[model samples]
Target: MLLRDKFCLITGASKGIGKAISEIFAKEGAIIIATGRDLESLNLMVSDLPVYSAPHLVFKMDVTKEEDVLRVFNELSQNKIFIHCIVNNAGIMEDATLQMVKTDLIHKIYNTNVLGTILPSQNAIKHFLRNRCGSIINLSSIIGTKGNLGQSIYGSSKSAIIGFTKSLSKELAPLNIRVNAIAPGFIDTDMIKGMDQKFYEKNLKAIGMRRLGKPEDVAKVALFLASDLSEYVTGQIIGVDGGMII
Candidate 1:
């Protein structure tokens, strides 16, 4: 019950790592506000979360759209639901080599990965400032820190997240708010499920642990950052990458 009675908002919460985080947080007693583009999927996921004193909510949000992001915050405010934590877990990845990458693809990647994180965070910061206490957990990727082939656009977008997390953490620390980023490596998720078989096996060899990480593995680290356990920890990019970089 590390997050007992806390209200946590998780974006892109319909599937993969985001869904995993939602489940774990709910089990620990956090009232989850799960958002995603698919309303049906979000509702289905919410239906499965562990029950708590405060019921979980499902919102259809396209993280790339500022209007969508603002609407969710406004609606929550109208209902007097003050979120204690925000996990910017909404993102997309379409890996392409430099030559194969197109301008539209780059825009798509940045909008969802970079602007997606920033908009929700910008709105969350307003609420956090009033409370003078909050937590913001951003999801980065190991590919951002350690460059990879055929993923230039996707990697750069994640790198932007690292910068955003570091700067915001410093700005909010004095107010007792925390901002941290989790850079997970090659987790078993839909994002990586489409890789070529040989490419997939090659990635397996790159991990020191000799196994792909599970969504729950990343979720546990997120739980730490969202709870009192990480009160003294901020502005850090934690790698849930199974020593992939080492």
Candidate 2:
């Protein structure tokens, strides 16, 4: 039990990597606070989590909404449910070449992917500051590091997350709070399922492993970051990309 008795909150927890993280954390004995806008999907996910000693909760939250973010934290505090880690996994991605990208779409991407991460992170920092210890694991992407076709806006949003994680890590280090980001590459998820087969094959060939990454792969790295295994790690962008960037 890497996270026995710990309380972890994960955003975008209805499916894909976020859902995988929720299950893995629960399996490791952590009480999960799974959040997403999809109530039905979230409830389904909660039902699927491993039964543990500590209870798990599911919340319908929009990370981009400041009020919603504040309410969730406030309610947790009122209940004395002190959180140990926050996984900022809520994000959105829409593909469009730079020339073909619409302004509204860019705004939407940044609002959800960038500001969505920040709102929850800001609320979590307050809790961590009071507790004097906590972990923040942010979800980024390889596209943020290595530019990809038709993903300029999405890449920019994730790039902002990388910067935010690095700076916040340094600011919160002295307070015993750790912040880090994981950049995944071509994980098998709904997002990837929508990609054209040709593009998928191209990415598959580029990956050193010659296969698509599973959500569990990223979840394992996230578990490491959230648990004591990464006590001395922070401000790092770990790529769970099967050496694709190389």
Candidate 3:
């Protein structure tokens, strides 16, 4: 049991990489608290999994709202379930250069991607500090580090996330609360499910693997970071991108 008797809170767990991580953690004997905007889809995930069907708590949360975040944390804490891991995976992308990006769009993206990471992490840190043992794995992106064109708003949000994770790692380390970030690249997801093949190929060629990454590929590394395996690792950005940058 890699995460024996642990409780993990995974945001954006209705689908994609978040869902993948939740499933992996649950199988590792960690009770999962899964959050997403869509309760129906989250419930569907719960029904589909064979891990007692209810180890995943479906939290209908809009990560942008601080009150909702604090409320959920309070509710979960009241149950006496000490959280051992927090995966901040909820984020949105506004694809456009800085000049072309709308102010409103920038606000929306930051609210979720940046502040979403902030508020929830604050709450998680509170619980983790009390226990003196925990892991916080934030979801950044290769876009944050490499700065791809037409991704200014999205990239900025993720870049900010990396800074936040690094600083928080320092602040929380004394309490034995480890913080880290995972930056995934070229993952095949529904958002780009219908993208043109030519564009994908052009992008895929950047990676040595010559293919798009799967959500599970990222989840495996996340499992490592979330468990005791990387307890000494903190304030780092790991690229699960098939050697794109290297």
Best by TM-score: 1
Q: Candidate 1 — which residues are off by over 4 angstroms?
A: none
Q: All models: lDDT?
A: 0.93, 0.92, 0.86
- Over 125-216, each residue of candidate 1 has an lDDT whose tens digit, in order, gives 87787767999999999988897999899999999999999999999999888999999998999988898999899899999999999999
TM-score of each: 0.98, 0.97, 0.95
Of 1 and 2, the candidate ahead on lDDT is: 1
Error of 3 at 7 (Å): 0.7
- Name the top lDDT candidate: 1
Error of 1 at 93 (Å): 0.9
Q: How displaced is residue 87 in candidate 1, in Å?
A: 0.4
Quote the lDDT for 21 in model 3.
90
Q: Clashing residue pairs, candidate 1?
A: none
Better of 2 and 3 by lDDT: 2
